[model samples]
Target: MELDEFDLALIEQLRVDGRASFESLGTRVGLSRTAARARVQRFFDSGVLRVAAMVHPEFEGIHAFGHVSITVHGRASAQVAASVAQLPDTPFVSVVSGRHSVVAELRSPDVAHLSDTVSLIRSLDGVQSVDTLILTHLLKEPHIPAHGPGRPEQFDETDRRLLNLLHEDGRMPYADLADGVGLSRGATRTRVLRLLGTGVVSVTGMVNPTALGMTQMSGFQLHLETDGTTALSVIGRLEQVSFLARTLGRCDAIGTLITRARTETVDLLDRMRAIDGVRDVQSWTHLELVKEQYDRRPLRANGAAHGAAASR
Candidate 1:
């Protein structure tokens, strides 16, 4: 569905605070409570918006995460991309136009598990080679919850069940959640509030860029001439930058940007180069998004390879 100014404003408000009361949201976006609720419900029903909990990997005991770029043989890019996208460990996958035909984001509990999953991707038919950039730190993630200082040491299996259910549907009512997890509604609400207060997971509305008319998306790898402190601060403020991370790889950092047109991308690249301490920047435009959901099941069941054979 096409999003007008009011719809976009409502969505933006939801992004900031998904659990905001309908009355509060209506006041923020110049709509009545009933109108705001109707707009949001319509978006959810039409699949234009999703409000879900995005967990912070480090807070969840996830240690290995990286970006894997795969090059494929002639006429095999689509098939290979589909195969890679199906793997449980690869949460985000997209076909792009550049040296690499497909790129996938890998997340695992440890390096060994990540290596096995990468090896499985390499073994896919028509796949040629894969290059990986191990992420060191997430410098800026507007969508994810801010990484809190402590991991929830008291986290248990019941917590996992609650988190998994929230990851699927963040707005699930306390009554339904309690029924699903066999807890009293009051207890379920208490635990959920704790999770949110601790920054373990954030339930926010994730907008589909295409529906908002910002269709062009690109990924960039940057080489830094310095420690990247200044670069990170400057780049993080740009509205176009949705995700940014420091990495241990050929490039010092990588980021994903969404723009309205190809020319805007070129303009953004020029701006990035002008930032002090940025030595070089390379980018690739996304051709198609094969998979974009954050699949937490793999990390939730740590040490289970899911058919990916161990690789040294």
Candidate 2:
């Protein structure tokens, strides 16, 4: 579906606040509430946009986040990627070019669970080797800031229920959310606003690159010879980059970039290589994106309750 200027404006607003009311969205986009609602529904039906709530894993008691690079045997990269995507705790999976056949992001409750998940991947047919880099720091994430150590916020049953509903539909009407959580509309609004203010929950639109005319996607592993800080500063401002992080393993920094064509991707990489601090760069074009979920896991109360109750 082709997006007009109004559609782009609406999408930008949703990216900032997915929970915006149709009336509010209409005001921002110079359309009537009914018109705005219809357009948004069309975008959803056409698979152009997805509105969802993403909870911070650290706050949800998930301590281990890993990026796994898998080298498969022979020419079964697609098959290996499919198997990896189906593996438990694997959220993001892609068949990439270069040394690794597949790259996946795994989230686990703890180190033991991460180890178990890695072992399961190794046991998959046609898998040659697996290298994992523990994600120690997140420099940036979609609609959220970098994660840091902070006290886990406490939430009661009512709060959990509210979060669960939001997770299902970030743009769910406040009236519907109130009814679902058994609270007055005003109270529900206050609670949701408070949760957002505290960074316990985030609601935003997750746009698919291909749907937005970005047909080429690639991952880069960069090693810097000059000041790491200066290089990160330069790369972070690049509009083509979607994901960037300071890694602790073999690569100094890792990132994902999206472009409209192979030629454009190559040009973008050349610009990256020309940066003063970049020493070595390994680029991998994504042949197929197997699976990607921003809201991969749910948030739950800590301790004994744990899996018994999930907020997303």
Candidate 3:
């Protein structure tokens, strides 16, 4: 859909504060509280937005995906895609239009669980290969910033406070947020820059594909020569990368998420392969997601980057 400027503005506000109130949202976007509320409802109903409980994987430190890749046979790709996508342990799935067939990311309780899950997927129909990318040290993982879309860039602490309040309860009052964070309406209002600034968090604009008349896009994993300096640099140059993080497992990066364009992801991967010290590129198109909570939480609470928008 060709989103209108107001729609984009409306989406932008929600992107900053998913739970942004109609009143406060109106204030930011120059609309009536009633009008703002209606727009938000429209976004949700249209699959353009969905607000739910998001748990930081790092907080519990349970079991995050450790770079597990599954490949299915020829036409079995569909069956393979469905089988793994439906796996109980699976969280993220993409049936890509690529070499690997189906690429999925699953989280388990422990390494043993991961082993068992992969074994199970391997045993599934049309299964030809499975690759495990164990997460040893998380440089980055599934994260959300202030305002981007579903995934946004890190906003300032001022903005983070707003997020923290919402994280606890998306329905919190802006007046309460302002008072709790020690700022007036206008001052706090000015800090929304964090939504567009730097930090660990990011936001993303989400729309239901079924409603939007499209299917999911594919993502490829690139193992680069270095961290923040190298591998990260490769990821930075990829235009198709909707999200990137320095993670702690098999593939130092993640975001095999549903993309708007498959060709973009592939083109980015190809560019990465040309970089020096770059090894091979493995692309996986997740088919189905028996369980996916990407629109969920940030990292650990205590471990949350100090002064983060979500901090206490």
Cα lDDT listed for each candidate: 0.81, 0.79, 0.56
The runs of at least 3 residues in candidate 3 whose Cα sits more than 4 Å from the true structure, single-residue gaps closed, are 59-61, 73-75, 137-216, 228-239, 245-254, 257-267, 270-312
Model 1 / residue 228 / CA error / Å: 1.8
Each prediction's number of clashing residue pairs = 0, 0, 46
Strongest candidate by TM-score = 2
lDDT of 2 by residue, 65-117 (tens): 78889999964898999888876588789998888889998778898999899
**Cα lDDT of model 3 by residue, 60-166, tens digit:** 23444555566666556656766666665565665656556666666665778778888888788677788777655443342433322223233345555665554
In terms of lDDT, model 2 sits at: 0.79
Give me candidate 2's TM-score against the actual structure.
0.90
**Model 2 ranges off by over 4 Å:** 143-150, 296-299, 303-312
Pitting candidate 2 against candidate 3, the one with the higher lDDT is 2
Q: Per-prediction TM-score, please?
A: 0.88, 0.90, 0.63
Sort order, lDDT high to low: 1, 2, 3
Q: Write the per-residue lDDT of candidate 1 for residues 1-312, one digit (tens) a residue.
A: 877888889888888777777888899989999998899999988877878677666655567888999999965787888899778677788999999999998888799989999899988998889999899888877545885714556565667678778866778878988998899999998988887888777888888777776899999999998798898789989999988999998899999999999999899999999999999999998998888756344234431223431110
RMSD of each: 3.9, 2.9, 8.4
- Residue 239, candidate 2: alpha-carbon lDDT: 81
Ranking of candidates on TM-score, top first = 2, 1, 3
Q: What is the lDDT of residue 202 in candidate 2?
A: 81
